[model samples]
Target: MVETSKVVVFQVGNEEYAIPIRFVISIEKVEGITPIPHLPDYMNGIFKVRGELIPVIDFERVLYQRPSNINELTKIIVIHTNELSLGVIVKDAKEIIDIPPEKIKQLGLIAYGKTSYFTGVANLDSRIITLIDPLKMVQSLDGIKQIQDFMAAEVNT
Candidate 1:
C-alpha cells in the first residue's frame, strides 16, 4: 500500500501548489516586514512573529516571476525546515487535503527544470497541483547568509 500525505494548499499567481503539512508550523498575517539589504530579491524581508524573527520569501516572485505585491490577500505560511524556520508569502492559502502517493508523479526533467521549486505533481479531480519541498527551497537559495548579516546589522545599527 502506498502512503499518503496531507498537504496544505496555497496559491501563487494563478497556479495552485501544495506543501506537506508536516513542515507547516503556522499561518498568520504579518503587519510589518523590515527590508534587508544585500539579500536576494526573492527574500521579501524579516518579520517579527510571536516574538521571533523569521525571514519571509516571496513565492510568487521566485516561482512565477511575478512582482511581489502585498495586499489583503497576502498571508505568511510558516515552514519549519532543517536549516531554518522561514515564512513563505503567498497571495492566498486554501484548505488542506490528503494526497495519496499514487496520485503523485515524478515530473520529467524538463518539467522540473521549468518549475524546479516543485518536488512533484499531484493530480486531483483532473487537476494537477505542484508539490513543493520547503527544505530544498530554503536551502537552495544563495543569499541566506547575506540576509542574516543584514538582519544583524539592522539590529546593531
Candidate 2:
C-alpha cells in the first residue's frame, strides 16, 4: 500500500505553503481581531467563531520575521492540533491538493531557517509547496494565558 496526504495550500506573501488537511478546521476571511497586550507582535490576538474564541497568530511573523501582508487575498486559516485551535494569518487561502509520500521531500535547515516551520517540500507538477508542521508552527509558551485573561475580563466587565 502507498501513503498519500491531502494538504491545504495557502499563500504567505509570494510563497505558497501547505499543511496536512487533517489539522485544518476551516479557512475564514479576515474580518477583525481583538488585540491583547504584553504578547509578541506575532501573536495577532483572538477572534470568535460560533461563540468559540481562537487565538490568531501572525504566521508570517513567526516564519519570515515580518508581519503578515494584508490584501484582498488574505485569510485566516483555522487549524487544530494537540487539542488546541489556532488561527493562522496568510496572504491567501488557496486550495486543497493531494500529494503522495514519494512527492514529499525533507528540507534542509539552510533552505529555510534554523527553526523552520515546515517539515517537508511537496514537489507538485505545477508548483512547489512547503508542507508545514502544525505542531511546530506555533509555540504555546507564553502570552496564551494573557489572551485568556483578557477575554475573561471582558466578559465580566
Candidate No. with top TM-score: 1
Task: Please give, for residues 1-157, the per-residue lDDT of candidate 1 as tens digits.
Answer: 7678899998888788999999999998856888866678888778887777888889887876676577888789999877778889998888899999889887775255445667889988877899988877775676877765665665676
Residue 71 alpha-carbon offset, candidate 2, angstroms: 2.0
Q: Model 2: residues >4 Å from true position, as ranges?
A: 110-116, 140-157
Model 2: per-residue Cα lDDT over 1-157, one tens digit each = 7778999999887888999999999899887788877777788888887677888888788767899867788899999877367899999888998889999888886255545667888888888898887866554334555655665665577
Compared with the true structure, the alpha-carbon lDDT of candidate 2 equals: 0.80
TM-score, every prediction: 0.85, 0.83
Residue 131 of model 2 has an lDDT of 86
Flag clash pairs in model 2.
none
- Model 1 residue pairs with clashes: none
Best by lDDT: 1
